[model samples]
Target: MTQDSGVGRICQKPVSALLFDMDNTLFDLVGAQIASCQEIVRFLGYKDGEELFSYFLKPVHGFESHENIRQYMEERSIPIDGMYEKACRIYETEKLRHISPYPGVAETLKYLHDRGYPMCIVTDAHSRDATLRLEKIGLLPFFSGMVAYDMVNVKKPAPEPFLAALEMMRAPAGDALLIGDSIRRDIEPCARLGIRTVYARYGDRFAAGHQDSGADFIIDGMDELPEILDKFNKI
Candidate 1:
């Protein structure tokens, strides 16, 4: 299945299944989170959204933890009786409202679905959050299953989540292609497991400087996926 088709070499086997990273890959989660943080700050009469958003980037409480909101309030000495809960609700609502699929996501997913490629989501988010985000963007129906942090109790860069997804889909690593935004979390771990990798360059927000992602292929947009798959299948 390896072919030097002028778009990097293809995988060693035809991709029978697709594994997707949910957050940044499927949609602009970082953008949504920023919007949500701004809305939260507005509700709290603050002018800086990044001040609150920084809490999520910290190692404490994790990125998706609502405790970030509590910490933000506490650092400012805001009363925590009912304000914290209201802020959490506002954050969740605004985040969901701002989330939408990237350009050509639905069409590409539909195209792959029509071509009989099974797809599953591999995410570090909780199952409930994953479902809510996917459902919000109307992409829930496209996936056959999901492997979330709750199920594996481990995040990416760890092999557990990807391995769980492969087992749930019943697809061998060589025959599966993993599309994700993070080189450390998504591409490298799956590559080690003998799975082919596609780095979604458009969705990458965390990589500060350009570095090799170690992906078998790199696509700038979801529309380019069909062509990549075509190359893989042509072998």
Candidate 2:
């Protein structure tokens, strides 16, 4: 169950499975998220839309959870009944409208799928939302399964979601490689479980480099994955 057809070698340990982070890994989630936030800000008629979005969506200190958003709005005395749900609805709609897979993602996934590599999506997103984006990008069919945030009632970096995905795929940690953009969420957890990791540099929304990230390999783009795997397979 190895493939080396003019690509590089497969991993020496035999990579039977791949776990991918959905946002900012397989697709340009940053762009989609920005669009979604813009729609919400517009709907709310914020005069300083960008500043407001940045204040709320800043990478480190910004709010991510619905509860956080609600709390922020409440503290600010923003009077919009059911504003959270409305924002969510608008964001989801706008995100879908702008959703797109990163360059070469579809081809790479198809190649791996054709080579019989089982793939699973492990995301901090809700199942329905993840599924919608995956389906929109045409990458859903290639995945053997998915582990959403709600599934394990925890996010990445906790290892529960990663483990849940592996369990569902019946793939051992050593036999799996996780490709993701976030070191904190994807790489750290997988590495703790003895799963190999490939840091997706291209999808790094935070623009963090490989300085302290313990990734097994670093790839600039998804197109380089097959070759990297081939080289690893031969090692």
Candidate 3:
């Protein structure tokens, strides 16, 4: 469909099924993650939050896995599983309580849901974690399904997860559009199946004009999506 939208003659292919990335795409992962890390550290009994953050920021510990963290705690003579469990407990009990959906997300999702769009989430995070993240934010009910890395053993930037979500939704890749923030991961892979893409322009780490400009369309925020649909209407 095409419409005389602000940018130009809008051309949107029919989109019966909409797939999204859950991490930085849905929630502000950088903000939520910073909060979660602080809460987890405090739960581990380091009353001074800065100390734990300091330890974690050390180059060797940066972006370590749960198991790597467990070993890190072990190397310091701390109980591995105990602290690990404590960290996870605090994240669930406390960190989750602080998470907020990005502005306009709920209303946008509701609008799409009300319009009979079959929405689904496909993210690179662990399956269970992405599920819980959505549930924590109260947005899980609007989705038809979800696909995560842990489930498929292959993440986006690889076609596996995106293809899996399309298959789960019973939609062909050509008819499905992958809308997300990451250029390399989301836009490139979905393009493999002739799937179009929409870049969530305000998402984390997005350059004003990214290094690789691959998305078929771009919107600064959820509020602009109605226009995107209008663009779709034109085609």
Candidate 4:
């Protein structure tokens, strides 16, 4: 069912609980990561920040960008002992400064919370990393439950993290909605378990695959979310 408002249209379903992807969905994750990487390279006295950032992510892609700094320094024969450790420290310190929630995210979350809809965060990020980001964004209180990659031996696409969140919230798969950017990681896996899927189209970074097959709904921004939930009377 589609409901058209001034802002956008929400394809509604019976949504009981919300399972959210932390990065990109809630905030500009790519922006924060790129900023941190660029600052790290500059701190290490290198002008080729963007090129090196690409190289660093090419092999071991994810949030663990600092781990590759050591290999990069060694490959270039930069002879900067302890530079890798120092770079990691710098990246960690600066990353928090660069992080914040996307516009409308905080208000939407508060609206959902006040209306008594259970919300859980299911992310393929280290617990420490996820915790820090939530704290920075002031969103820690809105989530009723969280499932982090590090908390489980398996990550997303495995269904373990999603299942964990469902269990934590005591939510049935059919009554829940999983929203995220990745088809491989979030949409497809949750769809396998019969949960409704909402593709956070604003957060799609790679643009490699289509969301058509898995997602039951698609939202371009957080502002569209409340209207979607409105069908469920969350307003």
Candidate 5:
């Protein structure tokens, strides 16, 4: 499922550094969150996990806020004090328990790392959650630094987080490659910054259908990245 834009050779400047989106790009964070929602609902004797999951999608409370759980409970007239704390704990614990990197992620990362490509993470997650997830999956050591939502106080689709990552890695936009799942947040923003982007199509869960991603390259899996990098280097 790899597709290239076929506009031109990618080596206008050779890629010297890598930037990655930490959530679905590296692992299925949404899937883990869904599973966590299911666990929470089951523990509370609720019938529909999807109903609980819908609360996180609401814009009132941020996606990661535990306040969503409270709101969900209140709507059902469920007790809030002890139950809210317990629900939050179950959600956090189960989410982390279910997280694992996509296949070949570690190998691809090691391949890139061994070849001297400095990497940084740009994520919408808070710093603590990002650190915990990466550490849980044992990929924390691979990144030189991270620009988290808490650090930049901005999320992707904004240029600030991407700029902060490039600065942290000391890599010019043209000389760095960013791999991420969301076209709107990851691809378009990086393209505007003159950074080459690899849209992780395999990780995308939000796009409605098969919309064109507007990325320089698209990879179906992490293992395909080395080949893309090879093309960049050879050109």
Candidate 6:
């Protein structure tokens, strides 16, 4: 009943590369994001949470759809990008103070970091804030590099961003494992890239098949990762 029994080697030395999702994976983006969404919408004169989530998540599925927003803004003769970017800048600078990692994350990352694991972050979050959270929380140096939606103009569930991360690291796709919270976005895309994925079920706001998910491995905590890797050694 061991996880990763049929996949890559597990010894700490055997697995040298780890790629993580930023938003909900390494940290709890939902909580802070919702808070920021509320603040931004209120600033914009909006009062509905659903509408706010939809507005912020517009760049989630893909950026092409953002063109639609851009167009709508242009039709109204408004500076869409500048306005949102400014609002986003404000949201991010303030939000990082509230952002937090899943329980045991700090120690687990420190464990991996101390072991010399080369880690990279792949995210579909906006430009400044996503990275700032990492830096503000002192987790920034743990990563060797990152690929964000603002950088590539695409979102998760799309392989390009993760692929770019792998390429940037000069690491083969098969040599990496993507650990994240979203099945459709994080797990699915990495799987397609032939990157073995670990579905971080712990601290996930959504359930696995229970909270509406389809991840590969549903973990209960960060400490279990070493055990999972140990089993991989046998496989």
lDDT values, one for every candidate? 0.88, 0.77, 0.70, 0.78, 0.90, 0.68
Candidate 6 TM-score over all chains jointly: 0.72
lDDT of 1 by residue, 27-74 (tens): 998899999999999988998999899999999998878999999999
Count steric clashes of candidate 5.
Answer: 0
Query: Model 1 reaches what TM-score against the true structure?
Result: 0.93
Ranked by TM-score, the better of candidates 3 and 5 is 5
Q: Which candidate ranks first by lDDT, i.e. highest?
A: 5
Q: How would you encode candidate 6's per-residue C-alpha lDDT over 1-235 as one tens digit per residue? A: 2244234423333555788887667777667756765675566555653454554456553422334334333544655656766555645554576688777777888877877778888888765756678877788878888888889998778889988998888888777777887778887778778787787876567663564334445676776666665544432
As for model 4, its CA RMSD to the true structure in angstroms is: 3.8
lDDT per residue for candidate 5 within 100-136, as digits (tens), equals 9999999999888888889999999999999999999
Clash totals for all models, in order?
0, 6, 4, 0, 0, 2
- Provide the lDDT at 133 for model 1: 93
lDDT digits (tens) for residues 1-235 of candidate 2: 1212222222478887889898889988768767777777677766444544565564544344545445545666876587778876876688788989888899999988988888999998889989988888888999989999878988778979988988998989889989998888887778889888888878886764546557777777798889867754642
Ranking by lDDT: 5, 1, 4, 2, 3, 6
lDDT of 5 at 229: 86
Candidate 1: give the clashing pairs.
Answer: none
What tens-digit string does per-residue lDDT give for candidate 4 at 117-141? 8999999788888889999989999
lDDT of 3 by residue, 1-235 (tens): 2112143322456776789987667778756546766776665655544444445446563332444346546666777655678775664555456667888888888888888888889887777777777888889989998888778997668988888888898998767767787878787777666776777767846475555446777766776666676555532
Candidate 5 C-alpha RMSD relative to the actual structure: 1.6
RMSD of each candidate?
A: 2.8, 4.9, 4.5, 3.8, 1.6, 5.1
Which pairs clash (backbone N, Cα, C closer than 3 Å) in model 4? none
TM-score of 4: 0.89
Clashes by residue pair, model 6: 10-233, 207-211
lDDT of 6 at 144: 85
Which candidate number maximizes TM-score? 5
- Model 5: pairs clashing at backbone N, Cα or C within 3 Å: none
